[model samples]
Target: MTALDTSKVSIKTSLAACFGRNLYEQPGAHEFLQELSQSAQEVNIQQGGYIFKEGDPSDYVFIAISGAIMLERSSPKGARHVFAFLFTGNLLGLSEFTVYSFSAVALTGATVVKINKRLIQNIFERHPKIAKSFHDFTTHVLHYVLDQMYILGQKTAPQRLAHFLLDMDTRLGRSSGQFYLPMNRIDIADYLGMSLETTSRSFSNLKKRKLIEIESSHKIIINDRAAILEFIDE
Candidate 1:
């Protein structure tokens, strides 16, 4: 973990970004943000550094201000599952229990703002609109997880890879149909529940079919978006 010089990064601004523009524009949003900023602390994490481990005290929630964070869990036998990769504006560390259910690590050098969970809950209690917006945000995350569960359970290797690419494009692509995969093939395999070789083979297969172009190990260009969609649908 590295200490961040947060003089220029506004905690309130980061919070507003994570919570979304709609919530930031809500009534009493200013007061809510002010309270949060007063207690928020920004931390910079080096790539692969742990943000919080599974079973750690869930005393704080975090907002990614920059870079990427990987949320994952490991079983007692050492089997691992990658839950999700969080980018800028993503909220994390909220749990239903006293301890974190999964671990968060910096997928890249990352900056995150941390706020005391108890303070946030108290503020939410006083701000019904903010609470509703937060509920909606969390529900949306839940839906994404459920969708991934379905894909992993039902999709074939190629289908799963296609879905993953499309999903990544939706989250990280530019207008040019290009995106950088911050994670490597092994990470993709772990997230998709496929072997690493299968994941790499799927990428090659897609490139061979001209549905996508792999510029490098980390860069992808969607050559035929429509065809890729059709492939997934088939």
Candidate 2:
């Protein structure tokens, strides 16, 4: 496998620049970021590599610096279920216990900064705003997970596909109305709780309806956002 910027350096070198150049809009976050990022170390994962497996001790949480990371779980029968694909600025390893409940794998070769979990408390003590940021982040993650559960239980195959497309559009596509889908059809089928053939058929139906267009099976273009929204089961 090809290397992807693997390094173990102090935050003062690279991440420090990321913090300063981002011009974080949050007031009073400068000191908090400094305090939290001090002991951070950067690690790179090549595509298809495992960052951490299920039952691994969650000593450190990760912040994606580049590429994509996929959170997944395997059933007793060894079927893989993808929960989420994390991108730059996304946090990983948020759990109620000391061990990670799911596995994190590199989808497209990712660079992530590993910060010890101990820093969470320090940040909360030093900067309440950053604590609020953590709260909001946790809430959004929970809501999205719950939304996926609901989709699995209540929505039809086509509806689920439409909802997933809208979600990608809102979070990743934004101004462009197009974005790269790192997960393949099988992964997406697992994520949406459907068969691979069902997932493919749904995509074909959407294209037939002129609601979306697929390019090279990875880059997607949403042609009719309003029409797609109508297909979402709510």
Best prediction by lDDT: 1
- Give candidate 1's TM-score: 0.92
Best by TM-score: 1
Per-candidate TM equals 0.92, 0.84
Clashes (N, CA, C under 3 Å) per candidate? 0, 0
Give me candidate 2's TM-score against the actual structure.
Answer: 0.84
Poorest 10 consecutive residues of model 1 by lDDT?
A: 1-10
lDDT comparing candidate 1 with the true structure: 0.84
lDDT of 2 at 17: 33
Q: RMSD of model 1, in Å?
A: 2.4
lDDT (Cα) of model 2: 0.76
| Per-residue lDDT of model 2, residues 114-223, tens digit only | 87778766766766765666776677778988988888899889889888888877766763679888888998898898999999999998888788898869889987
Candidate 1, pairs of clashing residues: none
- What C-alpha lDDT values do all the predictions have? 0.84, 0.76
